[model samples]
Target chain A: MKNWSEKTLKRIWKGILVAVLLLIVFTFSPWVLVKGKIDPILFSMPYHLWVSILSTILLVVFTGIGGMVFYHLKLKTDPNANL
Target chain B: MTQYLLLIGVLYVGVLFFLSLRSRKEIKTSSDFMLGGAKIGLILGFMTFAATLFSTFTLMGMPDFSRNNGVGAWIFLAFSDAVMVFFILWFGFYLRKRVGSESFGGMSRLLQNCYQNKGVGYLYFIAVFLFLVPYVAIQIRGVAIFLIEAFPDFIPVWAWSVFIVVVMLLYSELGGLKAIIYADFMQGTLLLIVVWLVAMNCLDNVGGWSALFEQTANTQPDLLSPPGPKGLLSPQFLIASCIAIAMIPVTQPQLSTRLVIMKDYAALRRMAVAVGFFAILIIIPTVIIGLYGALQYADASTSSFLGSVLLREQHPAIAAVTIIGLFAAAMSTSDSQLFAMGNEFRGLIGSKGENNLTPIRIAIFVFAAAALLFSLVSSNELVLLARLSFSGTGIMGPMIILGILAKKPQGSFMIGLSAVALVIFIVSQLGWIPQQIFNMRLDLLLMILLSLGALINYYVKK
Candidate 1:
């Protein structure tokens, strides 16, 4: 059962990694950057700036989530793992 | 202001010496000196990592970068850092696991063992030394310039630079890595506090967040958007920067050593997450401060603008603390890089150098002296020089990743590829070759080719 759970976590991590790469690529894309578009501001920030901030925050959240899953998987697979 | 600066500066130096002396008692072996005994917990691990990664570049360069380039500086640094911390989770695990069975040394030594070739280690050392010296120098140069601007005719910039290098060397040589880590914790906290206080003051002066952006729009709407006023933050440039910055953990020895020294995998992972949040927290203030610079000192010279805003405009007490904070910022990062390079040299020289800290100590002094000389001649383009350092060392990302992740380690070709790419990048930076080829940046293209090369090597060997 532990092995099975570990496998599931590993799969989730792989998925998260893919999602993160996509998010990063999209954040750097023309759609998000949209040169000279300062409209649709939030809290007085320009479009690209706010979007970039949001993207950074989202990436941090993903990092937190990814780290938790990674920790559990490592604990399971390498029981004698050097700390 | 001078009195406050003198008081706080003396106190700060006293604390640094106390920490160094205390750490000296813990040093019984080379590992204790070089790797801080490799038993770091989450808080110290994250703070040292954060402090080392975000140095004078973040504190001094970012505000000026944003003031000139606009909000895209966020994407340039903070966004890049967010990706970097996540990369750490993956890379750090593989690295720690690989080194788990072996006695850990610097990355140069580890790569030598990984590839069973001395050339791999030599290539890495040369690449890192060529790039990191200037990176370390700029830390000295940035603070030295700021101090000169803050106090005219008090001391020459070169003298200030020498003073910083001497103080940093004295403590680091005495206490070793443990002392550096403790100092980093203090510097990191001080950095966070100082930047936010200054940013809050800047924000208040410019009204709130909304009004600040409005005034910036009026001053230079280009500062409010992408490509910026100078078009320096174009998508291609930012994308390239993101790749370079994200590769920092994989390529930069100072950070890579921190990854290896964490007490456990759990601590390493937690450190990564904490660093991510820390990156966001540290960078946001620089943005506010940058936009503030835009409102007031947009056209002033870099030193002039920073002095007026970071020193002259603030309360005397606050200004004094800011000066100390900047000084601490420079030392926290420079000392680590200098020490890491010394450790790398020790790694290459074998156990003779390791068993006796004397040789390593001398190497550290030599490296510091070289950096001081470089600092004297280096430009004031702090952010760009830093990025170039990242990009130059970053070209080794594929070589290092292959070294770390390979199962059988038959990727000797990467050494030559990285060297060739490093040379070409340097030549282009020197303007012997065009910076862009077929409308793509040369550095970006080289990175793509190297990654592909590593991928092909991995599959073929597997």
Candidate 2:
């Protein structure tokens, strides 16, 4: 049971990693930064800025989730892993 | 305003003095002084890490950068920082596991142990010194330039620089790493509050968020989009910036040392998340202030824009806090880097330098003196100079990552390759060579070459 759970968690962790990378790539893509697009503003911010802001906030959330998962794996592997 | 500045300044200094003396009482060994006994808690850990990372550049330089460059500055700094925090979650783990707190003297010593070559350690030290001194100098210079503007008749720029260095040296020498961490906690809090207060002030004056952007659109429509009005934030530039910033924890000794000193992986994990949140919260206000500068002081100089928005427009009490906050921001980062360099030097000298703190103390002083001299001559382009520092130190990322991850790194050839790359990058910065190779930035090209070299070295050994 422990082995199965660990394996499942590892897959979730890898998925999150890929998601974070994709978010970063999307943020810098041409669609978000089209030369002079200021329409479709949210919270009164321009297209590129608002989109990048959402990307940043999402990245932070993903980081928090990823940290918890990695910490769980470490604890399961080594109960005395203080260092 | 002057009176508020004096009162707040005195109180801030008093707190720094008390913290230093309190920390001094706890220091029993050199390790206790240099590494805070390698057991920092999550809150203090996050605060110090955030404080050291943000600094004068985030406070002064980013607003100026955004004002000139446009909203793409958000992608340039905040987005890059978000990526960096996630990077810490991954890199911090392997690094801690490999160094293992007990054997972790500094990156220089750790690389020496990994590669089994003294020259590797020496080269790492040289790269950090070359890049970091200018970085420290700029922080000091940033605040000094602001101070001379705020109080034109009060003191000269060089005098303000001297005063900042002296105060930084005093507290850091008195209490060492622990004292510096306490100072970082205070500075981080002050910086957050001051930045938000100033941002709100700017927002209110502009009639709110809608009007601010609307006005900015009416005036500088290009700022609201990417590649900016100046065409500075191209995709290539942003990608290169992301890579440099992501490598910060892996390469910068001060931040890397913070990763090792956390009490456990769990604290480091929590701290990473908190720092990510902190990065977002702090940078949003900088974007707001930059847009404010765009609408009101569009053609103003960097110093004039900062002086007007951060001081001339705010309430007197808030303006006072801004000055002290800027001072705290400068010292928090400068002291950390100067002290870390001292620890790096101690790591190089081996057992003979252990137990006695005198030589490390002197090294810290010498490093501060060198930074002081550099500040006197350095330019006012804080953000770009900071990027140069980041990319310069980042040239060593491949070597350091290999050192930490490999079981037995026989990549001594990497030492020479890194040195040649470092020299070429420096020469390019000096305009001795073109900054671009076939339309790609020289820094970007060199980073790619070094990573490829490290990969080949790793596979051959495998």
Candidate 3:
């Protein structure tokens, strides 16, 4: 199969880029946005669990979409694609 | 402990033998034996996957965890089932559509092609076999101990071991994957019925869910919580669990075979939803059984009951439920392991050799014997053994994901990840690393590092 089409490649790269952005924002950001005050979301669930669950969902969804795009690209390029 | 159950065990073995002999005519070629020609339908696929996943470990160990920790144990069950579902939906379809190999070892060859390294392929093969044998043997010993308890006066532990070994070996040797799947389907159904009955009985005895929850909350609140037991599980553990789940869709042998067996991606996606639901349903009864024991026997030891009972020379009806449940769990896992190992041996050795069946048979025996030996010597907890094996496979998870995403993975990337994994493994084994390192989950660390390692290597090489 030839390389992925520009559009499909761009779609995959976009998904990965979004995931990375979310990771940086959520993982590294402070628990309380306004200094000494508490964060409402952190109280409901542990900060780690909240971050983990959110990141996991984001990673699985983005990677899945990326995988699907690449798969379709391969199929489009290959004359002998069985699927 | 129960005469009726003893009769059932004998009948179960006889039926398995009959099925084994019956399926021999359909096993002329290696493919037929190894993968049933990859023609498994939805029903067989679902049943086999359910049976293989819900082994004696879940039956015995899950409850033990619940008894000690509480709902946190359910997280383990949930993550495992989730991983299986993800695998069915994502990688299973593609792997089947592309490589279409029968065993995990065959998939390793595909990964080797991506990374361009034979050493990595061999490491994957060896790692799978080394860990799988002990896992299989644990099941064998579980079955043996169950029989010994059921027929205390008549059957010895060794005899029961021999009987289970012979029965599993005969069916696997003769009927191949098809026979194992059929047996697993029946066992899975029986286990489901029996587990639910036991759960209902336990609930009745414990005064229902409210009482059960109250008792567990008072005694072990941490078990019910997310982190669990102060230091045992942390955010790192959950992170590892998710990474492990993502890897499951790509790595596990039983789940991977489901991909190759499906008719198409649609079938696989449908199967994923079904399998996920079934797995969740199966785990509920297991959690209940474990909680029941925790409530009733306030101080029952966490380890195997056989030695404790032998010291006391008495057996209770509750113990019988535990025994039967343990038997179900062990059989489910052993059946899957046997099928996976048989297929792996056939794929690797049968491709090159003239006397294929002999090598396959030898591999089966060697695997069984080694596992039995290890089980005999090791006094460690069964769950600990299972966890160690899980960690061993954690290293390969990132590489498998990269294989799917990257068309041309760098050799240095593969070697670096393998080297890091090897170092972690050796450090853990040698006691050089702090205990917290072992306690703290490494699955997430390995996956993130390996992914970054591959990405960086790709760019550098380009």
- Interface RMSD for every prediction, one decimal? 1.5, 1.6, 7.8
Candidate ordering by lDDT (highest first): 1, 2, 3
Using lDDT as the yardstick, the better of models 2 and 3 is 2
- Among residues 3 or more apart in sequence or in different chains, the pairs in candidate 1 whose N, CA or C atoms overlap within 3 Å are A83-B263, A83-B264
* Number of clashing pairs per prediction, in order: 2, 0, 7
Q: What's the DockQ for every one of the candidates?
A: 0.73, 0.72, 0.09
lDDT of 2 by residue, B170-284 (tens): 8898988999999999999999999999999999999998998999999899999989989989998998998999898988899999999988888898898899889988999
Better of 1 and 3 by TM-score: 1
State model 3's lDDT: 0.59
lDDT score of residue B241 within candidate 3 = 54
State the lDDT of candidate 1 residue by residue for B22-128, as single tens digits: 99999999878988887889999999999999899999999999999999999999999999999998899889977886657789999998888999998889889
- Candidate 1, residue B446: Cα displacement in angstroms equals 0.6
> Which sections of candidate 2 miss by over 4 Å?
A1-4, A76-83, B101-103
lDDT of 3 by residue, B27-127 (tens): 87666676766666667777777787667666555666656654445545554455546444545645654563333335556666667776666666676
Better of 2 and 3 by TM-score: 2
